[model samples]
Target: MEEKYRVLADTAVLAGEIMLKAGAETFRVEDTIRRILRTSGFEHCEAFVVTTGIMITLESSKAGTISLNRRVSSKSTNLGVIDQVNTISRQFCQGELDLSETFQQLKNLTPVRYPEWLTYLCMVLTAAFFTLILGGGPAECFVSAFNGLYFMISRILNRRLHLNDFVFNMFASFFMAFTCIAIQTLILPELLAEPAIAGSIMALLPGLAMTNGIRDTLEGDYMSGAARIIEAFVIAASLALGIGVGMECCRLLLQALV
Candidate 1:
């Protein structure tokens, strides 16, 4: 029935919306929803819902490199239609739905927007690169950088604006950095001399945000993507701030020797 297809399409759209806003890919959601739908009795139906935020805005660079901003959000949905969509997706997640035949239907599925942890790792990696550029040896720099990054990212994700994220990273980074050094000291003493800067950097990459933003833009989901990009840049700035503070402290202490 035409009605059934509409319902199914709408359902797929909503699934995409939820995931996009939650930092997931449109195609990924579509595939999952479709998989769920196909396995359900409503497989023939196509449902769709246009999210308010999944819009993409493109910007072209001077070099003619085109970039886009992605954002995704839900506007409204039909309860009855949504309920059916929910049933299918839920069933699929629960393994109650059979989509063996529909598996290939999603080969081109957009990337599954990465979770926060992945984003954090990217930040750490970026930080490590910078730290290495700064005078810290490769091994030591990563040890300290990653230690700091882990505490910083973990606290930030689990606590957001809460004092926990802030204070935890502030203090935990130092501890984690030391822990990394200690571990290296015990297992790979060769790495003990690696700069704390490197360790701190490794601990800070926010890979997810960059990937999510790009993915969002590609899917014409600008709202979610822009928001994520802003967040990622903010995190990058914060890492820079931390490094600056550390450098300042070192400068002050080293002044006496000079």
Candidate 2:
């Protein structure tokens, strides 16, 4: 009994460490944990709040059978109880942490961080350039540009650049706004208005979030997915804010020219 419990705790600790290091995106971590616990027959569970996220601990001592103790602390905001259980099951069977990074690779949070604008510029350029290549109309291209720029920038910055989420978001929005202006300028005298509005805002689409959310929900992990869905909506709104500002700028400029 003591031996089994020790195994569970050690494996949980290792898995938690990997999730923190790799930025295991919430749902993946939770699922991994859930699997591990179920396999170990630790039926009861509770999570303790931690500054980074949650520390889930479980113990199940059924009848005369010894007992199983499962404990893990995860820093990721995304993983929920179900994921934790799954992780436990895998651990019980394999004696290895099943943790794998679902999002971008982890990076060291560093000094000498470039200004958000510079990071934003790189992101916008990546998106806008791709949009132009797709031969989208100026408006759609710009919309796609907004989508690509901010998200990719966020991904790189959040994942690789190791910046704060809010800081990255604000700059991504502003950069998207700035880049939209440039995009408007490069287009021929026509092809501006509705299409442009559509294009620039397309970056905020719920497609990615929706898919991930559904997967989590269907797997019986509701909490984490709900959080993800909320996050996606908030990000979409942020992109809209950028597109709106840029659209207003375009509108005003055209009015002056006329």
Candidate 3:
């Protein structure tokens, strides 16, 4: 009986952690945790979730009480994991899944992402099209695409190095700005920096973060919403700082050359 209760609590907390780290809204995360606990035969279950943490408590007259808290340090957008967890939870609720089976499924679930080459190609196209949309000529579009390639490489490196989002974005933006300015000055002197920089930087914006923040706020998860909003702003500020530093360095280099 004690082992069963422990498994239930562990499984519930694991599901919540997965959902939270995968960028699910806070209310949705809390609901999922509650449902899992309730379906597992714990009627007096409580779950509290925020952007960076999760707390769950389960109690029964016979089984005493069990509580778990998880601090989520890193977060990323992986809708695939979120959907898989949701499906498992629904199946559990409907009696299609047992606790052991559900636990194994969650443990075995792997996040799916686009292939690296395909992702790079898509980013390149995105940068190129954005440049063209912003009144850039064909040459500028090509330059922007080239810069996007470098951005993709930097992103991959940052991921491998386990850098934080703010540091990664700052460095990636700096690399983009520096590369664009150098290419413009040396290879295509006529290339406009504004369009290339703007278009390339568009690929680095935290659009999903901001959207999730607003959604969480509207759902009444005010604490999580505020945290996500601040996170998005911090990332944006880092990108801007990197761009500013890169531009200033380039200006100084040009002045020295002349």
Query: Which candidate should be chosen as best, given lDDT against the real structure?
Result: 3
Residue 90 CA error for candidate 2 (Å)? Answer: 4.7
lDDT of each: 0.49, 0.51, 0.87
Query: Once model 1 is optimally superposed onto the true structure by TM-score, how far is the C-alpha of residue 55 displaced, in angstroms?
Result: 14
In candidate 1, what residue range of length 10 has the lowest lDDT sum? 57-66
Better of 1 and 3 by TM-score: 3
The total of clashing pairs for model 2 equals 33
CA error at residue 139 for candidate 2, angstroms? 10
Count clashing residue pairs per candidate.
56, 33, 0
Output the TM-score of candidate 3. 0.93
The digit string of per-residue lDDT tens for model 2 on 1-258 reads: 656554544454445445533334455655454454454566664432211354556666562233333333322233433344344445445745322321111122121246767766665665555556555555656565555555665666677767654455555655556555555565544544344444444444555566666766776667766765776777667666756666566667767876
Candidate 1 shows a clash count of 56
Q: What is the lDDT of residue 131 in candidate 1?
A: 63
Using TM-score, give the best candidate's number. 3
TM-score attained by model 2: 0.52
Q: Rank the candidates by lDDT, best first.
A: 3, 2, 1
